[model samples]
Every structure is written in structure tokens, then in C-alpha cells.
Target: MKNIIEELFYGNIDTQARGFKKDSYLQKQIMIMSNSEEILTERLKGDDKKTFLSFVNASGIVLGESELDSFIVGFRLGARFIYDTFVDNITPYDDFLKEVNNEG
Candidate 1:
């Protein structure tokens, strides 16, 4: 098998291009959100509409950042699990904290 790092470096791994199955819960919710946005946008006008849109865009940015943070945390946790499995067992919180602090 080809190396994952090589594939990622060559732009072959597009993690951002995720998809949801048709008629799935996520798809249904996305449809509902889109419909709601269209309906609300039609009702809003002038400054109110612009303000609402700006708010929506800002909220989306915040949510995206939060999701990225969560993904990073989960990835780190998975790596930590693998480390614990194969490496020397260092399960104590104080020991972990000391090692982390020493790294910095």
C-alpha cells in the first residue's frame, strides 16, 4: 500500500470533501436548515437581511473552528491510545502532565 503521508502531501486525500448518505438524518437536517434559511431570507430586507446574513456567516465560522478543534482532540486521543497500547504504560494523569510540561 502507498504511504498515507505521501497521498496527503500529493493532494490525493481530500478530507474536507465529506458526504452524507441520501435521506440520512444529517441530510434531512441540512435540507431543513436550507429551507429555513431561504424562508427567513425572503422575509428579511435591507439592513435586517444583511445583519442576519452576516450573523449566519459568523456563526458558521465559529462552528467550523469548533468542529476542527474537536477533530484535533479526538485524533490526539486516538494517537494516545495507540501509544499506550505499544509503548510503556504511563496512564497516571500526573505523569502525563509532567511529560507534557517537560516537552514545552
Candidate 2:
């Protein structure tokens, strides 16, 4: 969970830092909140797509729209790495935060 949050932070920073090309856009929008469910209705219809609900933050250098699968693969790898790291390092919040912050 912590690893996921870290990845979310990095991805969000990167997307805004570099700016996305109109031709190859990627985003990390909020998946949920304590607000109304109006805008989320259409998105919910696409829920079976599964990929849409996941908090995916990506940077696509691929030009043309045919490379979506490739982008999904990249996001999957990023998610798996985060999940694995969290699994291996699970502990109290303070300990985890301490190690994570001190790694650098």
C-alpha cells in the first residue's frame, strides 16, 4: 500500500513535470472520493474494462494510438514491482516510513 502511494507520487510528478503530448497522453486522476457520483457514472459503465479503475500513472512516448497495450504492460510492471516491495517490507507505519525515507 505504501509502495503504491510512492509510485502514485512519482508518476503524478513525472506526468506534470514533462507534460503530455496530445498524441500520446497519460494521466493519474483520482479513483474515488467523498463527493457525489455524477461524473463517475459513465466510468462505472466501463468498469468491466478493469484497467480503467486501477490507479494507473503513465508517460507515453509512443506516438499513434495503437500502442495502448504496450502502455498497459508498462503500468502493470510498475504496479507489480510496487506490490512486491510492499509484500516484502510490510511493517508498522513508522518503521516503513523510516526505511523508505532513509533509503536515499
Query: For this target, which candidate reaches the highest TM-score against the unseen true structure?
Result: 1
Tens digits of per-residue lDDT, candidate 2, 31-94, equal 2331223344345656543443343212233332446666788889998998988776655565
- Give the alpha-carbon lDDT of every model: 0.90, 0.53
Error of 2 at 86 (Å): 0.8
lDDT of 2 at 81: 93
Which consecutive 10 residues in model 1 have the weakest lDDT in total? 88-97
The TM-score of predicted model 2 comes to: 0.26
Error of 1 at 59 (Å): 1.4
Model 1 C-alpha RMSD vs. true structure (Å) is: 8.7
User: What is the Å distance of residue 93 in model 2 from its true position?
Assistant: 26
RMSD of each: 8.7, 18.0
- Please give, for residues 1-104, the per-residue lDDT of candidate 1 as tens digits: 58989998999988789899989999999999999989989999999999989988999999999999999999899998888899966554557677789999
